[model samples]
Target: MTSCDRFLLDQPGGTLNHIRPVPAALFLAASLALTGCSQASSSEASSASEDATTSASAADFPVTIDAANGEVTLDSRPERIVSLSPSATEILFAIGAGDQVIAADEYSTYPAEAPTTDLSAYDPNVEAIAGYEPDLVVIANDTNGIVGALAKLDIPTIVNEAPATVEDGYDGVAALGMATGHVDETAEVVADMRAEVDEGLAAAPQDRLRIYHELDEKLYAASSHSFIGSVYDSLGATNVADAADKQKSGYPQLTEEAVIAADPELIVITDQVSYTADDVANRPGWENVSAVRNGNIVTVDADISSRWGPRLPQLIESIADAMASVKTPVG
Candidate 1:
């Protein structure tokens, strides 16, 4: 089974044995959830199959889709589309649907050309978005309140909830494709992304190393159940944070005591906090940790590492570089 597939199947277990790459079977299972059974059988089954044959055809009219929060349907191709999340904005640009984007949320800064529409000014502004007369609304699942408000206006909206892993990221891309009437282009993009990730993994060293991913200075971290944890799995590293499976949100805080026990060889931090080897070593009881002693603590770009979007390949490579820099004992 591929590492990506294994990651999708792993439950909230606190063991390192479940840390291996995911099998193809698991990848299939994870993907199945993206296309709901009801929609797959009725609307998407025929449309997707037909779309495969006539790949170039666009939707007859502007259509609205709400795949993130739940499945929503639209009548035609939406001419004015508003994206409520940065990830959604990235997906639209990737699938050749950037032209339809009339407005985007505050953080949709990628691709440089995506229209700077301030929905809510910070998050999602249902009223400002409504002002654009968007034929379609692309929202994140977490933006339920805004989605509800837009629904009242009878605007066709597609919601992309948070993707838990890299596969979910691909599914988001495909979902955007269906919404923008560019399924073929979306499929192509996913294929290329999968291939790139595969190549990077193949080139990595065989000795799978132990890693601890620190989300914040508070000792908050991700487990096998989270997408960020899955990314660590893909890069051939074992996540020590997988030991804490109590939190359903995928991120859980670890006691400094628990971290000392796990004693991962490598420590990774996302934020650019002014932390040095001595800072980590001097932590209350973390003085003896191998990662701190060996100066293996590394900080990564939080935006790319945390956000599951089109730049995942870059994130993966950045992680690989960090792993490569770890110092090993001389033979």
Candidate 2:
């Protein structure tokens, strides 16, 4: 039969008007046999693939990941780890992987037990990291030349991208869990954190108070895309800068003129910044700004507020308090 005729004969809903009954039965039996063989082959292949993955997981082969910077794989679990960022260090501890961390950057002060490892000391410090004989290094920031230098030294590094939003933070916890072989523990920690945040939001004031986050004396502020902006949005507070056009690059500077125009009801500053409520109030034209005049300026711990790590719940609470205290209207 022609291809079109064969196709019509094979299809249940197709034109079966021209087929001889005996020939059609024979063709259907052959087709069924071929289909059965194909399905059996596919099932075997799938089973084999699954077996391979299971064997790989059981063997715990040393694997390196280049996407997060050259993180080296070790046979079985890593016995020694070094963290390059405070956030990464915090994650390691949070996931019950703290026992694996042998060293940490000087600033990895949380949990009170991270070994102090100086980034400046490593040969470009890659050799020194080798001297520490670490099985893995967790990098939270890639701005420094460490990522490239570590690759040259054949060291394993895992670079963590900072979580830009609340959901991203939860995902980060899970990623750390998988990387450190502590998935169950990490899930528990994430669930607890999410519950805390949800409760904070539930109890937060209902009014959409205008908020201004001040990062420095020059009025550097977070855009709608920043971590702080995410916190404000979660708490139902209105970030005055949310409407600003510079929402792409994270934090952006707002001119004094613009600040005066926005006239936020609440101003939040980081401890590292020199500006305070009095400073803003004493500014040449800021005296009339409702936030300054009404003393609604609050300073937050820079490390907790700026770092996107385990202390995020505290950051959310601080923002909630600032918003709750807003009792002025900026013109």
lDDT for each residue of candidate 2 in 1-331, tens digit (9 for 90 to 100): 2211111110011222112222222222232233341122366554543332222231344432223443334445677887766777887898799999998876677878878757531223666667788777776655457767776766567666665687766655554554566634654566567667877777778987778887666566775687667888888877777566454755677788888888887888766564556676788988888788788888888767766656778888777777777776457
Q: Top model by lDDT, which number?
A: 1
Model 1, 1-331: lDDT tens digits are: 3222212221011111111112212222223334432123455554444433233225332333336456466556677998866777877898799999998876677779988654542345666788888988776654437767877899867666657778777766666665667755665566667767777676665567888877656777777668878888877788888778666667777888889999888887755444654577678877678788777888777656656667778878777877878876566
Candidate 1: which stretches are off by over 4 Å? Answer: 1-56, 60-66, 117-123, 272-282
Which numbered prediction scores highest in TM-score against the true structure? 1
Error of 1 at 116 (Å): 3.2
Candidate 2 segments whose C-alpha is farther than 4 A from its true place: 1-75, 120-124, 243-247, 329-331
Q: Model-by-model lDDT, in order? A: 0.65, 0.62
User: What lDDT does candidate 1 reach at residue 63?
Assistant: 31
Please state the error at residue 170 of candidate 2 in Å.
Answer: 0.9
